[model samples]
Target: MDPRQEEQINAQVIAVFPDKVRIIVDDLEDFKIAEESLKVGSYVKIADNENAVLIAIIENFQIAVSAEGKRDHIIEAFPLGILRNGKFERGGDSLAIPPKEVQPATISDIKKIYEDSVPKEASFRFATLSSNISVPVPVNGDKFFNKHIAVVGSTGSGKSHTLATIIQKAVSEKGDGFSLNNSHVIIFDIHSEYKSAFPSANHIDISNLALPYWMLNSEELEEFFLDTEANDHNQRNIFKEAIIKDRLAKFSGSASEKQNIHLDTPILFDIREVLAYAIAKNEEMVNTGEVYASSNKEKAGQPKYTQGSLHGKLTNFVNRLENKLNDSRLNFFLGEQSMKITFEETLQKLLGYSSKSESNVTVIDLSGVPFEVLSITVSLISRLVFEYGYIYKRIRCAKNPNEKINNDIPILLVYEEAHKYVPNSDLSKYRASKVAIERIAKEGRKYGVTLLLASQRPSEISETIFSQCSNFIAMRLTNPADQGYVKKLLPDSLGSLIDKMTSFRQGEALLVGESIILPSIVQIEPCIHTPSSSDIPYWQLWKEEWKNMDFAAIKEEWYK
Candidate 1:
């Protein structure tokens, strides 16, 4: 039989709707083949007309026994798109087909579907179809990076490997040695797993990551220092006033007069001086009695002044401030040896824009940071990045209206374990980071900032943030709640396809949304430089021979 004639009518369409089609298979052998193809997530093509083919996925099936004892296989399919005139297209005005005109499509038709879906521009080849035919599955580079994306899966489902693959492919050069020179990607590495993966990238851990105390605004300071619910209003006001005064005193005469300083101004100030001023104000006496003459000439006539009304109110506040200043764990915020580093220097260091380095990727390792201050640290860094991008774009656009902007300093902010910071519950402890990240999700694209959030528990992440993601790389998710959460975020037409997510093999994922021409299940390629996210060898360690313990070294480090 000629292959072109294989498009001849094989199955008869018994029912049809706008979104679904039902076909009948009467031939015993053909019924078996159609039954095999009806498995969920498997694709099949229906002949919509002489030249147009309708691609659909088998979502369900039923076996019917007629009164004459003959068996009929009914296959229910969800239409994905229309392949017409040798081109695969979606959402066109001519997808609907009349009933009884459909025919079963052949393997040659499937090949055409894959070929027409390959992106025309620069793309990253992630996987091949499981059919062993080596059909190239490519994701458009521009759409994947410019839009916010989410990577969610259960543990050991290859989420880390997927992320590493994306980053490696992004930073690596093309065959022609063409690289993205202006791309800046910052990974918030919670487990310190990515430092080894990108050896050439700029890596900053808690040991060297410095965020001066003055960088925090009034609201952040309040969140960190004052227990607003517990602290007295008078004491809080005193602290605020002292901070304002110390910030203003950083500038002198002409500069001070011209500068408009707010509570959130980034300026160097001696924290000790602020503490001392607050203490002095608290200790100042107020006259409770009328003026009186003293017997001694040196005393002359003076009205006795009692201790200030706020003397004892600030004792606890002062003690808490002193403790934070002395704690070595907080050295990142308080251990600046000199006040000479300007705000511009701080921005350059945090944004990885200093003159010493031209590398575009910066990985911030958060493993060493104390848990008490982790939320604020993440909040401060994220807010600074957003603000810098926002201001830089405004200034550039104002300077040259017709300038060709190639996204010179566009930043891709990747957050691992995103649910910890952007939880759905309003009672979460990391409110600061949650608000900052949510702002970026809603409006960051306008300023060349995009987010790639990775989380194991998609249900726990903020709905606003998750819903705003335009792309998703969903790996195996077994938990019902997590699976349901991902399903809710996708379009109704893809729900049956998403149902297979729980059973996907490790390293296999469904890449959907704006990044690809079609929703596909891709086998993610292994990263050349893999992260240290593999499970520990517990059995191997248990089988090892006993060795001498280093008690002395352990004790010394523990004391330090």
Candidate 2:
């Protein structure tokens, strides 16, 4: 240690309370030299230019002195280059101390960073974390979910589990949010998963679900009854009009009766009914001239009428409709099935049908709903919610200032298989799933109706919907496309953490966005109630099989 070297050792006490110091250097032209050459976390020594003992940069930079009390000026030694007999420190005179490096912080550290942020999930019941891997923080009116949210992931990547977990969590919250007087949730179960997952939900199995014929307008009914064989636009309308009239006559309330009248409106009729009517009329039209029936064959003199152009058209339509109804795949929408309840029953149930008391929560299960009409049913339900919200908001703010409004009640729509509805494509039109989701994403926030989407395919989800989500608890996504999609969607600050999604354990998620201070990789708490997402252990089943059964017994047992 030298005296002259002490002058070259420049340093400053930046933080006195914590005893922190900043090393002063001539030029950091090469950060590598500064970083590697200096002892980031160590004691320092210094020497003077004349190679004389100067000071030791320890508790305070001071000249070294004898152990026995000696001089007023405490001399310190500063090393020009740290020397341990044979080594030469490349950097300048003084060294800086580095903080202790911790390899990785605990899961609580990850959760706390986000939990302590704005629009915080301060007080919500903890649900199954993303995929049961990361902790799920259920948000309602008090949290950011009152705005908008989006979830994305790859197929079979536990998107459905994540969504189901959220719905369950929200329902729990609503039941617990004793302050709220009403909470009506209407989910559009596109895949029928929601219908089954939440049994308490008003399940509208589209199969048996029928809309009151009078509810449809003339144009809608026309579209519904558009004849395939009748290529001529004019001819199609004529047939459509006829079908509408028949349906109105059949379902409408009678004019004379003043109640339950028929034929006072325009509506859609079953293609079967329309076809029968057209066939009978075509026989008479054929006798007239321009319009005619094909056959005439009655009891001898009373000849029966044959099929005509109108009859054929109507008959073909009925056949097509019948075929569609018969197809098991398409039967969910048009089939005559009893597995599901009617739409009217569902609607009434949702609107406090039996209970005079307005409930704060409603779950619409789609498990019994058919696959084909799942999307359609979901769209209709979402539309109904949107329409009601619009109406309620208006009335609350309308004329009477003193009129009480149920503003505290917020309806949250949860989608279990969210990616299907908001796919990566331009789902701007031609998709019932897309339209329903987009409506919730675009307008639900304003009316206090929030949406929580859960999906595994972040890459395949619609960008519009994904971008709207301000808060996210993303689980592990190993697929590169899905990882890339989330990376693209999240903020730049989360780059370091998101890069680890592929390696994250199932149920573990990266929590970020408005609710988080810094993006975190969290280990979520387990769900209170277990959901139905579990794999069958084939090995366990095989172990139970034995040679004690005959062919019939084996077959029966195997089938069972």
Candidate 3:
């Protein structure tokens, strides 16, 4: 901050606006920056007459030649904040008519912007400034996670690695305490990529995942069992009546108490019994003096028969239900474990809680799950967690009227490739999942349940869910739609700053929102336990010797 540095003017501030500043250097050979390197996302400092300084991020570069063949380097930057009186302020500005001088921000000057703004205790450092790896970037951990977060980028842009890095840091850092922390995270890993990242996590894949058919809500049940093309009202009514009767019959309560059980209740009932009831109704017979096998036939006995009201109505419904039951892939839903598993045990598994050793993460590997029920699976799980938070909060408040915390052990639900389940489309298959997730996005904050949504295409995700995200780590997005979608969610002041997203290298991200002290371009630190997301080196592998294959084993699993 010495005034003597002003004597060596490095660049000229030609134009200054509320949100941006333009600087041009007439002599490229004598640019003489501290680092002797410059890039579009680098930070620079400009001083006004009162000795106050403004920090800006370089957005774009342009070069022009004069008539005499002299070159001028034009640097356009977005103003981030102002530093005055040894105090750094974020996004408030006042300036004298022509700024005193502009200079490439020295390392100390740059560090002051981030270090002074956030308290040491609240900082959660997982990445460093893209311009300087030595300068670490820390965000407010509570605000970042309590509020929903989004991590979006194109394929091969390190979106997976970035998410893994944040989660690893979260689980590993507990203020130099014991080996484990209460931090709980459940990742819906569509491609089974996170097991390596969290080796000790409670991993559940199709082989052992037990999602009872009785756990699905009414909407999910309809979507799973009803045919949208046929849209049969009789079939729906039959299914509803069957489940309700089945639930009532299974309840050991009084007649009046059985009235409380509805079709959508989470109470466990035999789906097979419901299927049997449907088949019986479809083949039911009634008598209206229709046909008689009488004395003309012979001596033993005689009977009259007629088709009942719903005799043929439920034929298709029975077929669909029967096919679903027969499919071996869906055994996870109808398996004996699911029928026997209690709600408390299922919750413990999802929350990574146990009397023995407990882990901080639960990875649900969906790769082995059947595709037809993906939405239903996601919906059921999300609903379970949200209800856990809601009911847990209610119980705490009931016990202690002054209890402020909803859940003593809060949980974070992460959806890798979230768009696949919660796409913007209004298709029937996505309805249940969308409703479940959208409810969380709107109300989960108070109940201590939050989401971390990571996807390659943000534009394709549900807008209601995306808009609820208070923080975003946007990496290199080459697609215009994805870029524009992100731009719309951020503040208008950051429009130019976001333009630098495409130019970022792999693992570089524009970290912005309520969590961080300042919006900045940062390089995520490499995770100690990497995910299985690395791209294959096809060319080099092809040049090497032929690799052996185990088609028998592959086919064995494939058939199953």
Say which candidate scores most in lDDT: 3
Model 2: how far residue 157 lies from native, Å:
6.0
What is candidate 3's lDDT per residue for 1-560, written digit by digit as tens? 44545466667899987787889987644454544477776778888889788888888789988999988899988888878898877783676658887877776778877787678777788899988899988888888889999999999899888988999999987756588888999999999899998898889899888887788888888998899658898998888998998888778889887778998788878889989999898999876654444545652244566788899888888999898888889888877887898888888888888556588999999998877789999999999999999999999999998997768989999999999999999988899899999999999999999999999999999999999999999999999999999999988878576888898899999999998877888999998899996578999999999989999999997887
Q: Relative to the true structure, how large is the alpha-carbon lDDT of every model?
A: 0.76, 0.49, 0.87
Model 3 lDDT-worst window of ten: 293-302
TM-score of each: 0.88, 0.59, 0.92
Q: After superposition, how far is residue 450 of candidate 1 from its true place, in Å?
A: 0.6
Whole-model lDDT, model 2: 0.49
Maximum-TM-score candidate: 3
Q: After best superposition, candidate 2 residue 397: deviation in angstroms?
A: 3.9
Better of 1 and 2 by lDDT: 1
The order by descending TM-score is 3, 1, 2
Clashing pairs in 3: none
- Tens digit per residue, CA lDDT, model 1, 1-560: 44533454456777777667777766535433333343554566666545667777667778899999988877887777778788887642365556334544444566567655655665666665543335566767778888899999999998988888888877764456554456678889988999888887878887878887777777677777766557578767887788878877766647756367767876667778877987787677898676656665675577777878787778888887888888888887777732556678777776667677756678899998888788788888898888887888888888888756624678899999888777897743477788889999999988888999999999999999999999999899988999989998988767466887888888888888886777777788888888886588989998999889999999986765
